[model samples]
Target: MRIIGRALAAMVLLVTAAVAGAVEEDGYELWMRYRPLDKAAQSALQPRATALVYSGTASPTAQAAISELQRGFGGMLGKVPAADTQLRNGAIVLATPASMPELAKGLEALGSEGYQLRSTVVQGKKLTVIAANSDKGLLYGAFALLRAVGTGAKLDALNTSSAPKLQLRLLNHWDNLDRTVERGYAGESIWDWWRLPDIRDRRYTDYARANASLGINGTVLNNVNSKPEILTAPWIAKAAAVADVLRPYGIKVYLSARWSTPLELKETKTADPLAPEVAEWWTRKADEIYRAIPDFGGFLVKANSEGQPGPQDYHRSHADGANMLARAVAPYKGIVMWRAFVYAHEKPVDRARQAYDEFKPLDGTFLPNVMVQVKNGAIDFQPREPFHPLFGAMPKTPLMMEFQITKEYLGFSTHMAYLGAMYEETLREDTQQKPGGFTVAQVLEDKDHGQRLTGMAGVANIGSERNWSGSHFDQANWYAYGRLAWDPQASARELAREWAAQTFTPDPRVTGPVVDMMMLSREAVVNYMTPIGLHHLMGTGHHHGPAPWVDSLGRPDWNPVYYHKADRQGVGFDRTATGSDALAQYAAPIARQYADPRTTPAKYLLWFHHLPWDYAMPSGRTLWAEMIAHYDQGVGEAKDLRARWEKLKPFIDARRHEDTANLLDVQVKEAQWWRDACIAYFQSVSGKALPQGVKAPARTLDYYKSLHFPYAPGRG
Candidate 1:
């Protein structure tokens, strides 16, 4: 036993050393790396920093803020600031306005959760004041300052005040308890639940640090298809340990609750929302969880969706179920995030319209503490999708936008598709509701209409991979999600530049081409996979490759044929008044715009209307010709991405550069595969010969249809 124990101790030591060593070597450190700045940047930053003085009491958050400042300063300038009670020359002071009363006067406009950073003199000493209304705000301000330093910004005359536009900026980890992540391309789940409660991994702390730096304050740690066992005593204890680690970073931990937990775990007769026993059980469970972790965020429930149990099983409304959970947690100031992604197979309506039909009626009925989380698009995370109808339809309910950061539909990290542009495109789209200008972001921010608490949630792609997110470029998606969550109006191009500069280097040559590649990456993937709003046309189950010919699934909604509706006459699902009338779900002005394919953006042409194959497009080409052109263009772009990456070989690390280069090779081949497979299948249905200059597919349509992938990753 002693020999075994010693061996384990040695293993632990070696692992710790390896992790610490990776801080310098691995790109997985993400944007948190406080590497020393260039000589010019160092000279510019050092003159403004002499000492660090934090006025607040030594709480965990305060300490973390100070530690981050020290780490950033020590690495960036080769100088660690001395922590002192009084400000000195060139000192940086961090404090909440309440902690330093005199400083409160100037920071009044920073708001309750906003932060202010200003250069000022204190008692004949020059100092940089980092002041906020709360400790969490102060910590966020510190991180912002560190980020500016890392990005080679001038700090001498800095005066910046910022706050999150959205209330709940969160990352929903689709991680199961058994360590397999749903749609996670990186690896197994990062949550080492087996060793938790007693032994916490340092990675958890770093994860919190990365999230907090981006102003993300909440995380749901489990998959939405929850397991009842997560509510057990052992799992609750494990969650508490993680909460303890994250508390300092101001990130509240949340869990996805299994709706039938009372029945599954406690041997109850029924899990009815109106039942006294079920209500009491949930209340007691909430009490138990709050007692273990004082600031437990709340629950994320995906009930009655894709086989999940819910109040509907007992002939009750969604509001009934959500209100029940809300009442249970309201006493503890916790909110319930009830998903709006519900659908029933029994319903004979369009799958895209189901969520809107179900939730629109329950708009004003939900409790204030309950938020109905809606996906960015009406359908599942497609390569491209029109903004969800619920974005503007729910005027009385607070809706949280849920975006999938994991590449479920966009080629799963193997293809470089930057989603920041996609997110921004969705948010900035004019819903055209009300008289004045109104966007999806405005719909979220319009608190007067009872859309009080706005939130943005990204399904996390992070796992235990050495590079954090499977591929080097994949890290940019995580970064982009956080930046947009903080400020939805942020430019995707600018965010890509910031990430590239910090992650790779600040060289214009390196960042310029990389950002260019990233900005167009998403469109390229869409072109190859589902251009012009074609969606869910991937291979069954795995969703890794193209299988546009798949039509034999069990249910109509489960089949790709139902979504594309490609036939001899035309292609695309008709959601306008002529078909399902799904377009009417949006506000009138926006609906009118999409009602006509001629006026609707070409990017979403097929999504809104089913057009003839030979219909004229804005590009002076027929729809079929345009489709062929897009596929050919996508293939060319993938080839260009490979060549551009080849040019960057000298600038990037050999390992990462080569890795990305090889992936681009796969991407190019797959792009051709998608083009050929889709063209062949569509041609077979339309019976149209290939347009001039568009080469015939090397393989027959039957060959593409016969392909199988039983062992594909992310198939659950």
Candidate 2:
């Protein structure tokens, strides 16, 4: 009778807790969750971390470091360690040479943003010291310390030194004035433009913390397709309000300014770069912005590209447009990020060749502060594309890497495609520009190129969703981008492992399966969606699902048929000597290899050279057979990924675990859909039969084409 009463009491307690909403972890905590550690491990490490000491002036950035450390320790260890000015045994000390003269000599090696963290006995006191040249570096060091502990690094034996490889690491938000995000899948834009100047959201603080944790320093707050009002007086005040919050975290706010802003705002008759009134208007605008936000990072302009106005509208070159804005901001130490994505689809030539054709000849003409932002590939962010020819081609101008993090071409936020592997592939590709002298990274770092500044930008996937990014896994891509931007040479696999450990659990069993799933994710998306060099085969408008059969769009570039060129005689676009000769745009070695279908790497075979359906591949299978096999392989990978996530249920929290499990289920279903939809359309165009062992597509081409998502998220 007593035992039954006890059981009944426990059941009541459980029900009451559920009714009151016992903590359900939505992923708003990102990698900085700092959740409580396992009791046994916490007990073991507690003695080694008995004290915390900071001997520096309490600058806002330095205080941020102290506060973050306290929060991390409190959550992870179940108690905040003692804080003091004097170092003690087992103390974790943060100091700059300016504060601690004893640490001054060693800190000279670490640059302004660099820091050295080491464990040693100082004055007979065994301690861990994070010494840097400045307080900003101390804040970065603090985050690094928390990251190490969260990822299971031993604090007692810590020894590490680090600095950023790139000077500018930025997130380009495609958020519009109306809070509608272009290509954003998570939710509405996080920026509440209507209430910014008066009401600062706490989410803004969390956003700054997240970026600082990863060493990201800049953010462009609006879409490249920007409205002129963003540059007006009202918006400048709002920007200042947000900037004040982010300043202490070491992040600067940038804006995407319209090239025709002066005209659009009715401040000038024309926006021609050479026009004196237009030049005066931009100069005044820069002055106004700088006066409000003293450290405002300048404009990101998308010009005569996509019908946006530019110098070209008045018969001037891209250099003229970029330089005019550069001069205006030069007085205030701001930059102009001029996009190199301009292309004319009206031209019959290959779309891949157009950017280089327009910008190559005027390479040396851009001003020092003008960074020509080039997309990772010559074509838009496809599933797979060769590195852009412009990377090492234009040595005289500074070029910034623009990688899209929104997954616009890779099935948005629903699909589980990790982009770390994709970034590593492009960053490592050898440009072979001058007799083995340069890689893509090397070109940007080169002093001879007159590159006073170098940077990388990612199109942000962040939104108002509780998880930050739409899916739990999509957060990994955002984390990966910031880490890569800080150090271009870092390994994606290592980044994935660290992120998996910090984000989910440090347990080998949980992290092992997660990392394995992430490593192969992007390849699986490529296999099912485009396979071996096919590009941009999604729906005409929303870019959701497949519609490779669509032929009648306004412009040829907007149609999938124009890209793939699948026909009864052959399949694949011919960019070789016989067709558009786009291969010639690359250096001699690359051009020579891609000139022939047989010589090109099988992964990029169809991209550079078109081939017949019956052409034999190195895999000892016919081209049609190989493509079908790839599609089948991708579907299998998706199923495997879903199964792998199920194994993590024992380790992950119930809420996050279930969310990821459901998303993975969607990924598997979509993978099959992508495979079937693409295969059906190609078969119709090529008039080919499936290989003997390969299964037929699940539906007809017309049925797949009939699947429309006119109301898909992120179609603003």
Top lDDT prediction, candidate number: 2
Q: Give all TM-scores, in the order shown.
A: 0.95, 0.97
- Which regions of candidate 2 fall more than 4 Å away from where they truly are? 1-12, 15-24, 447-451
- Candidate-wise lDDT, in order: 0.87, 0.88
lDDT of 1 by residue, 26-107 (tens): 5677877777778887777786888888774678988999999998899778889888877678888887756877875666
lDDT of 2 at 534: 86
Q: In candidate 1, residue 187 scores what lDDT?
A: 89
Task: Give, for candidate 2, the lowest lDDT window spanning 10 residues.
Answer: 442-451
Clashing pairs in 2: none
lDDT of 2 by residue, 1-716 (tens): 99999999999999988954534678888899887889987986686567778874688888888888888888899899888898788888887777876754576656788878888787888888888898889888989999998999887788899988788899999999899999999999988999989999999999998999999989999999999999989999988998998988889999999999989888899989999999999999899999999999999999988778889889999999999999999999999999999877667678899999999999899999999999999989888889999999887888999999999989899989999999989998898888855777776566564428899999999999999999889999999999999888889999999899888889999888899999989999999888889888898889988888889888888899888888888778888889998888888998997887888888998787678899998899999999999999999988988888888888887888899888888889988999998888888888898889778878887788788787988876
